[model samples]
Target chain A: MSAVEHAVVDQLGTAEARALLMTAEFGRLAFIDGHGPTVEPFAFALEDTAEDTAIVIAVGTGSGARAAVGQTVAFEVDEIDPVRRTGWSVVAVGTLHGAPATVTARPEPWPDPDGELVLLRLPAERLTGRRLRRETRRAGRR
Target chain B: MSAVEHAVVDQLGTAEARALLMTAEFGRLAFIDGHGPTVEPFAFALEDTAEDTAIVIAVGTGSGARAAVGQTVAFEVDEIDPVRRTGWSVVAVGTLHGAPATVTARPEPWPDPDGELVLLRLPAERLTGRRLRRETRRAGRR
Candidate 1:
């Protein structure tokens, strides 16, 4: 059967979304550069605080996003079953900040580094997500 | 072994990137809304012409991206091997547009539709990608 034939969509809460975000090791970061809106996949670590949750990403010194410091950014993570069309996607929107020198719990950057790698933060301002499920529905069901 | 131990990153050409993008069934659409930069996963169909390669997405009438007509946007698709630390990611930057009524080819929209659904196009202006691979280095190799 086709995926759309039995798909159901549900919204997820911030807490649940954050929990899912933590489980995924990597996600895509979306930001604006001189050309336009762009996306790049990167590995990230999460930092939770009493007030907010932020994402720590390791980027090369030459990365375009490095120049996008202090700008607004969105990081997205999702798990989808292409065959069944069931999955969940979460997005966190926030301002990008360089990690303070005091923090020492940063995750290791992927593809290993050649030169210096800098850590940038996307302090969580908004967290939202949705889950899709495939379920057969009975006739006349509301 | 970890993905970073022998990882090498390579840039992909426009044709190769577009080909990789066509292999994936779904991708994340990055756009700006009232709040800030946001990302939403979407299923898409590709149309190639002498002029440009356009991404046609089926979205609900109530979707946020539907309101982003004529705005610059980015669509991203990637496949990564967490264990092997190898995979490829492609990003397509373009301007969003409403699809013409005459078009017939469209990918099925996910989560099922409540009311009417519309087809939106992101006419790709730039297509870029990168591949990560592992190569064991000899002890004597620099």
Candidate 2:
């Protein structure tokens, strides 16, 4: 009989978490809207500032995301292999704000048939990550 | 020169959104933590009751997700093709609650090295989704 595989979850440190965040160009942004708490996927780019790294996203002027400015939000990114059921996820918590004039490395804006686009930045105030690894264990083993 | 491709975003209806949600086995759950808002990935399954569908997840006793019970939360799932820059994302907003004994279709719990596991349920009060499609346009075309 084939050995059963179980997942082992590991917590990642700050530096390791930030390193992992840099590897993905897309993420889900969670914020509160009129209805309630909601999440939307966005293309993101990391910018290095004098103090820390910031996540930048470009959205249309009429986008509900524009309202997220000044609000605390969570940005999450992950890479999962469904067949293997193994992956790592990283979440950055911070306040969303309008981008400064000096900001660089903006994500390419999705074509907006509505109006112009604007850039929003979120300084990763706190970072946490976890990795799930599957290991083979003999069947019936506790 | 080859035509440039631009992303076109489309909003999906409720039936379409729920159907898309059923196609994925994993998703990110966003909830408010002690520090602030945060997100974590988890294995999830959809359960059908007489009235509506519910999203179910299993977590260890020590899991922070337990705290999310009774609070409004957002569960998001998406499938993105990095190379093609095309995919769909669905988000369900609802209050988290402890699973009832009558509930069925529990997700397989991730191995917990610490303790026992429990199931949590979130009845998808509201469902929303969007799809990104890449369409090629001739150069200099508006």
Candidate 3:
């Protein structure tokens, strides 16, 4: 389900990146586990407090749950418009960290000890984004 | 363009993955550089050898050119589908390998120099993928 059709790399303000992240419900977290690399799907909530910091919180029981903690991770998100044949993606790679108490206590559905909530405060050491352009013909231009 | 609207992971074959990668002229290459981590976008060509491997070949100048040689790297390709409200992505994290003579002769275009024709061999590691599912009513009878 990966559409790598078109992409353009650009850097935006951390605030803007945080807002763009909020528009999505989930993302694929990529990490290097054992002998090779791995990617996992997780539900995440983005929080923008510092100018260059964001928190992606997720709680799961999968192997990725434990390994992701205290490790370098990459979060990949994309929004595609099939009809328009256009789309874009943004990637933020940083460290997996814990969340603030006040932030965790909010309406967030982070898994409690009942399941264990794992959080990652993405410092976003690197952020690369791309947008795909759709072919368009001017009026009366074949 | 980066698709941040809807994204879900799904499993796919090398062909399905290659199809998406080829449609787009460029994708990102990530590696553990001497300086923490680095990611760069490059144009590549995919060759499905008789041997169960999807090869991605790319070339560059001083930028990431030589750095990629003989090193292990991960290449990511993705897109977003608005109508479907889902994101699709494919990542091949393997060795940054050299291309066969034939592959080297006929390289792909990057729409720019520094961007060379690189070759990636998809051991077809993990066909990890997904897509977001939005609720939609079934039939009128229902």
Candidate 4:
């Protein structure tokens, strides 16, 4: 936490959210598993096709997401500075599938690189984001 | 990404996961909305009561998490250094509810001030984590 004691939280627009998502290297994918709602972080890249833009992630063949194909999932990515308490988070929700697009070749999982990996894609149907702004007030400083 | 090109990823035990959770000041709470799955980040603290270990987060009444009461949710927190491409992430899944335990008064949201805030609790039934380790190799220095 910084000496900054004030913050402003603002909701971002769709285009802004998409732009932010493109800047992130990894994000968490929330999907239903045998236990229930589960979230796992994965390195991802944005894929653009003729029809739409999708968030593509690579995971090991044994990863749980393989069972969640066709399910509606939420993908979230954010950059927050713990000390400054300022950052933005963007979330995209849509259907998850196994079809690998041309862009999928670019995203490789940081872990399990040597293992058998598969590409999972989520259509960016709904995207939303929020920005947190932090400011510090110095004493005797106008 | 760090100059270190090689890395190792390891699965963490429950105790290690919980310990990591305690070290982070904020995490993303994944919950369901009428549309579908959604995720939002919030500053949180781990609360240990007589009954069980609960994750406490404070949000304004207008926050979506208020609707998460009685719903099973997944809470995730992680710290990853993009430069080093290494970090650890922990996820806790449980049912959400409204109970201002002794730990409730401690956590304060960054944007929302006092008076309008409400404490939402999640009893962590399942906790898991993973760590990424990066190592750098020099020519003839292996």
Best-fitting candidate, scored by lDDT: 2
Candidate 4 residue lDDT tens string, A6-100 = 67778899999989998989899999899998888888878888888898887775467878899999999999887788899999999998865
Look at candidate 4 and tell me the lDDT of residue B3: 52
Error (Å) of candidate 3 at residue B114 is 3.3
Q: Which ten residues in a row have the lowest lDDT in candidate 1 chain A?
A: A1-10
For each candidate, what TM-score against the reference? 0.91, 0.93, 0.59, 0.87
Global Cα lDDT for candidate 2: 0.85
DockQ of each: 0.72, 0.61, 0.10, 0.55
Tens-digit per-residue lDDT, B5-89, candidate 1: 4667788999899889989988889998878788888888898767778988988754688878889999999998877778998
Q: Whose TM-score is higher: candidate 1's or candidate 2's? A: 2
Q: What are the runs in model 3 whose C-alpha is more than 4 Å off?
A: A1-28, A39-45, A50-52, A57-66, A76-91, A104-117, A125-142, B1-26, B62-66, B82-84, B104-107, B115-127, B131-142
| Candidate 3 accuracy as lDDT | 0.53
Q: How do the residues A31-116 of candidate 2 rate in per-residue lDDT, one tens digit apiece?
A: 99888988888888999888878999998854578888999999998888887878888999999999999988769675333467
What is candidate 3's CA lDDT for residue B96? 60
Task: Point out where model 1 deviates above 4 Å.
Answer: A1-4, A139-142, B1-4, B140-142
lDDT of 3 at A87: 58
**DockQ of prediction 3:** 0.10
Order of all candidates by TM-score, from best down to worst?
Answer: 2, 1, 4, 3
* The best candidate in terms of TM-score: 2
lDDT: which is higher, 2 or 3?
Answer: 2
Model 4's CAPRI class is: medium
Deviating ranges (above 4 Å) for candidate 2:
A1-3, A111-114, A138-142, B1-3, B111-114, B138-142
